[model samples]
Target chain A: MALKAPLAYETKHHLSYYECDATGHPSLSMLISMAVQVSEEHGNSLGLDTAAIQSYGGGWVITSYEGSFAAQQPINGEEVILGTRAIANNRFFALREFWIQSADRQVEYVRLTGLFVYMNLQTRHLMSIPQAVIEPYHGPEKKRLPRLAKARELKDVRFKNDYHVRFFDIDSNRHVNNARYFDWMQDPLGAEFLTHHQLKHMTMRYEKEVRYGQTVTSEISSPYRNENGELTTDHRIVVDGQLAAASTMIWYE
Target chain B: MALKAPLAYETKHHLSYYECDATGHPSLSMLISMAVQVSEEHGNSLGLDTAAIQSYGGGWVITSYEGSFAAQQPINGEEVILGTRAIANNRFFALREFWIQSADRQVEYVRLTGLFVYMNLQTRHLMSIPQAVIEPYHGPEKKRLPRLAKARELKDVRFKNDYHVRFFDIDSNRHVNNARYFDWMQDPLGAEFLTHHQLKHMTMRYEKEVRYGQTVTSEISSPYRNENGELTTDHRIVVDGQLAAASTMIWYE
Candidate 1:
């Protein structure tokens, strides 16, 4: 019989006060932090250490991500399980999936899918993944990495505003939280907008993940302003054309 | 001139959700995790590492700490400073002070004093300080460390009955926020007790500091129920024989 490939590794985490938002639930940034930790662990389990990857002249860089949060989040004292798996890998990219499940396993509070690029650390550019790095995972080569949905420029959109990444936005991973991109993507709209309009639908696709120690520009496109009075805006989270994430938010009256 | 004692070192940190509290400030427990990292740096300055301490059949453990908070706490994007000093050491114990400062030097959000003891890791019992550990700090010996004020056990305090550490109470340090003790210390009577009952007289003295991964037991003495009808309580935060902290709340209606 052919050997079986493990789906993923699991880690347990406890909720901390720092992870919560104004609503008392874990903040969008914290949800991303948990996802990154699980991803790192997934890489380590495959025998890919920082030095090992560096030695290959490339490092893993998150290219894009999509996460969906369902129901209310975990609160303080809750024991959460974070799990990740290697879905597929290619010469230049890899795809991974992560989840945060409740102890009872009855509910999945969060689900995330991310694409990462193998990059040359020195040149600060994308590079091909080495077979040495790819062969160990045993994922299929035929898998396709999805293309991010195009975002209309803010000038073309109805809402436009700017925000600077604050100190707290940076995590131990030294990167902006994946979920926070949603905030920056939407902050330009006023609270009046958020209150009167709820996010009826959203599709965020990442082209790059912003890292710590760097500043980027976030631009939003005009809302499509649908007939039912619902509004939809398209956004591009960018660090100078390394498109970080492209998203669309549909708000309802 | 002897260099003003190499006082700090660098450490990488992983941001965890529990570290931030309800106000979105990095809680006391998170501060301690960074403090522990700084403490490890202080030991490294003395040529001590985990293996070195273990080789001697004992390890350093913190017994107590006293911390003062400034007006504002650390929020998300800022890079914080971690520092420690072996202020004094005696045959039995050592007193170390650790701090988490803002990057711009604009704030010293947390000022902490820790009491440490050398103990046999296997037995989990206190042992005398080794000459090897004490000789490096180069400080005069004192019979007793500076004392912390004790919370008066009062008989007239009211119990509010609404204080509990939630799951988010746990931080990266794996403990509840020490400042939280103040909440438990103050909450029993609730804010109403504060407004109606004149705190004409109140005091809190911390004897020991709490740490991560430990459960703290708190109890308050019955209010004496004076003629004024104001409630008062004597609060004690304890673990085993160790007195963690003490406070006395008084109300004058």
Candidate 2:
């Protein structure tokens, strides 16, 4: 589903020089982090801060994320607005939409939708969403929530790579941050391909987790031409030869 | 001289989850990035935005940085105050101070000082700082600025390892980011030492640049006990058997 939300919370961020990768634009991980930051700001404004949620013995856990990038991306030293809001929710899942746009809001940079499940920090089990947590954002509380479409598996994978999990990739959660998987997915594609093509939309499905001291292999299929004649790529990650994550991207040549 | 600026330019930031490392504390690069972020905010407030600075045909280029960490560091989802100010400067170099503290400003997490030189972007040649650029900062201009204490060379090096520069390490400048050298310096120290010892203070001096696909070897000296009962370690990085960067760190047992 596309991200459609009335912008109720907005935060302005300055892109730092270090935030950019070898390319001039912001990295995928940094973009994802900015989205998460804006969402937290929105929550803090509504009194649903991390401590407030943790007070209930549970916290929000992202189950899936799908994002679409515009043709224009934010560059270093540019001011970008990161806005987010809770769009909808069900008994167990809360759907939020996030956007990164130019300072004037006239140009949108990217839009993202994330499915969050309430999980207990102690037991690490799924839990019901508390009413107090969702009452402020004023998102609809429906019984059923939409699930993100999964990326199709690669059938004729050509390129493959083995990546050693670096200390920098792992977060406080003791596992690799989900956003980092995007780097691995693109690393195998090489700088030549990434520099020529611009990413339009990408979907990430993290089925398993990669921990520190573990090595994961990534496989990519040759660029496929869609009906619209645009370029597309399929990616899959495996640990111990078991599927860990799958992703797909539509790129503009 | 140390980071003794009168704390004036301040910006509050919410550290994202992806900013943390395996040990659960904010990673070194992200901490340095946040410092840069606040410094930019300080510049923008003074009408010294990138566009305005570029009009002079030169921009602020960091020549060296020295930082010290407090015992308490922030974790994921924590709000921190990033403060920076131009304390002193000369015709060629500007000395600035930075700090990361708790939101309440009660507990300081880290303090840093950076030496910046004005450089012509096109020619990559060092240039004198324009008075118009330094005037808005309201910093004291003098004939000479304090230089950062150099990182002592390592001797009797026992531990050594090689790290191939990843494509992601390269920035828009087509070279590795200066802060990334810390990762290489620390990588050779191993996870066991990193997990136990806390970084209290460190000084880094960039002698040479590492490019993509280059293998850099890091050599670390044996642990030495200072008079104050603190631990100290010195490190040096060599590319093709030549010095690239060197660093020193003080750790508490």
Candidate 3:
């Protein structure tokens, strides 16, 4: 018998000029968008696409994310292979793993883990994953999966800036696109640090949904560029003066 | 014997949920992005993609746009075909036509025309189209091209709203994303009227480029709902109180 490869859904994506940022690298938001796209494709390949889940009056709602980026990232004009696989799941929670790697080179750009929960689309209440929906994946059950580091509690933030959520920020979900939060979080770091440093890893937790016409205030605690040479920061997003989201980012030296 | 395509190109795009607005349809900005995508794919097929054009020290710059919409637009989760073809060109001007239609039905969703000017990317000066850039396209020459109606001149503007351009609005071009102009123009109309009306047609002239951190004001003349049951309005985007862009819009009853 011939050797078989591990079961994982794959897609090839060519980076367009517009998908890049001033730095000629894919923006954080674009990275998330690509992840979402591959996940959708994976679901469809497994016969558990949006339509399949919707048949049960529910949908998969992402609850949190953890991403680890290689020191080098893919640049514009690069074609990358994006691979994703369902990792494991409990009754209410499903875990998936994703990676972006160079198609022609031995470079892995990033690795990602996403936590999603099944929810009733109408009532927005958490629900158990249907067997028919999960069966096609062949994902392991009760397998120990990668865990996300807990973000430091944010308080007494010193720097603050407000961003008015524009019409473009809202997606078909009638809420701000989750990736937009990275922009809000990073903008507070200003152009100096953002241009100088590259993100090594990040953990973001989406707490509340932001709507259009709302102003999100982003606050950051003064960074601790420690002796070990790693820079760490805590960030929070406040909407209408209420906490909407939070994250912690660690940057490579 | 065989026939050939009329120097036209097309690509099918599945409208993802994130591409849509709260109204469950693709947003105006996303529609424009799709147009840009198909246009790029068309150029790639013709061997005149961004890399190819930049190699000649030049690129195509959009000078203006005119868009017409069908009352019914494609909804989220639908696949639509985007088609574009070069209509005609002079030395400095190339006019192109585009249309968005349903994949399964005989319904046309929107039609657009874009006027482009060849320019030196470094100097931003007008240049003649290179033969290499135009050869593969096989677009006809001197055929009468579609024209956008000239926008009515603006006088003293009374009603106006100011918007501060956020950092995210800046794209790889180092300028405000052109689609941001539509949001700035429509927001001044307020939510109630925007929710009920649909844009029938619009002619927008890109007079000046807006930059990040700049504040621009959107001014609109009082709209007139005519005897034909159509609503017409004139809009101007003024940056630093100088006319940056202008447009005329007609809405379906």
Candidate 4:
């Protein structure tokens, strides 16, 4: 009998200076992109590439993500390890986990969990997961998967900014890159807060997809203490008064 | 006698899907970023890193770029070679050449030449090239350097779009990433032209540095035939009615 493919995969990446922000660390969007890249690589390694998945008339789309960051983030030009693992999947839902850490494994920079669902690209509706695509990972089928943390609604908006989505913002997936949400969500906080504070934790939920040539208004509430006494901020991306995405971020000085 | 360092340097980079556009090839901005990265690596290899150059109270700033692309472009997940060579320099200016080719050296994807000048970060004024910074490259001293192709002024604007500079667009250099100009310049062309056509040659000139929180208007002229009978377009970026950057791009279907 042939050995089964591993459920997890890891790859080494050199953090280029272009990937880093003004803080000299990898930006949140780039980190998310890295995770997405690793997951795709994992799928490809298992012979379930995009073509194979799309052949089932659907593609995987992320629904939500919750993650935390370590105090020490990897700097530009540093070599780090990116990893992803298939956790569980059912007929309609799949769960995956991701992380970025130092080469020696001494420092884990980020840890994230994402919930995904197969969607029919032509109709843009949820669809049942394909067995041929999911079975290769060997993730046990679960009747019910654990839910990701929900993003809180924005209340008492203190800052708001409007952004026009440009052409380059879209990727090969034919939609705005999901990682771009972090940019819109965080830009309203201004550079002062961004430079002085570091993101400790975040929960983001994508409610709808934003298209090209559309404008998005990102709003954020003033920093306040949460139940855990952490400095927290609530963010929401609205399109024509409809909430497209929401997130809550915890920051530390 | 000590041997002088080589005037040219080369490195390999794997093009990630995130770096590519909806067309499944690297975007113009990402290609420029890759060139900038290799040039920085070249400087570092010669013991003239950013810190060493900043010690002279100035940094290298690109004034112009002119490049041509081959019929074949590298796609995502492909490893390509990035190379840079210090061509020549004078007291106030330097010229460098860059290229991106296949790993096997069989296909030359992009060949570009950039004109650079040292600028004082605090005063934002042109400064004389520092000896310690330029001498290590071993580029011959020139009385007068060759000028890049000047961008034609946009006439009879057929399309225009506005872009709000986001915080993430700024890099560690504390200003907008220069490569981003390519996005602003090409976005107004619309997706139809971008998807069906491939950039054959381009010449871009930067006039003023764009800052955060500023809205820039990008304008482009309709496709017209040039003297060489090649289909061409003219692009210009304006800030507060002032021309910030200009470019001319030749495209092939």
Worst lDDT window (10 residues) for model 4 chain B? B1-10
Best by DockQ: 4
Per residue, candidate 4 scores C-alpha lDDT tens digits across A121-151 of 8798999998998888887778999888888
Error of 4 at A94 (Å): 0.8
User: Residue-wise lDDT of candidate 3 within A1-253, one digit each (tens)?
Assistant: 5533336988887775556666668877778877887887787777776677889878888878889999899976678998898888778788888899999749989898888888886677889988888767767766455567767777568677888787667766556678888888887676567667888888888777777778889999887763566798889988877878888888986
Cα RMSD (Å) per model?
19.1, 4.8, 4.2, 1.9
lDDT tens digits by residue: candidate 4, B71-175:
899987899999999888999999999999999999999999999999998798999998999988888788999888988888879989888887888886677
Question: Distance (Å) between predicted and true CA of A15, model 2?
Answer: 3.1
Q: Give each candidate's fraction of reference contacts reproduced.
A: 0.02, 0.63, 0.48, 0.65
What global local distance difference test value does model 3 have?
Answer: 0.78
The CA lDDT at A127 in model 1 is 86
**Global lDDT of model 1:** 0.61
The lDDT values for all models are: 0.61, 0.80, 0.78, 0.91
What C-alpha lDDT, on a 0 to 100 scale, does residue A89 get in candidate 3? 75
Q: DockQ: which is higher, 1 or 3?
A: 3
lDDT of model 1 at position A209: 55
Best by TM-score: 4
How accurate locally is residue A161 in candidate 2, as Cα lDDT from 0 to 100?
76
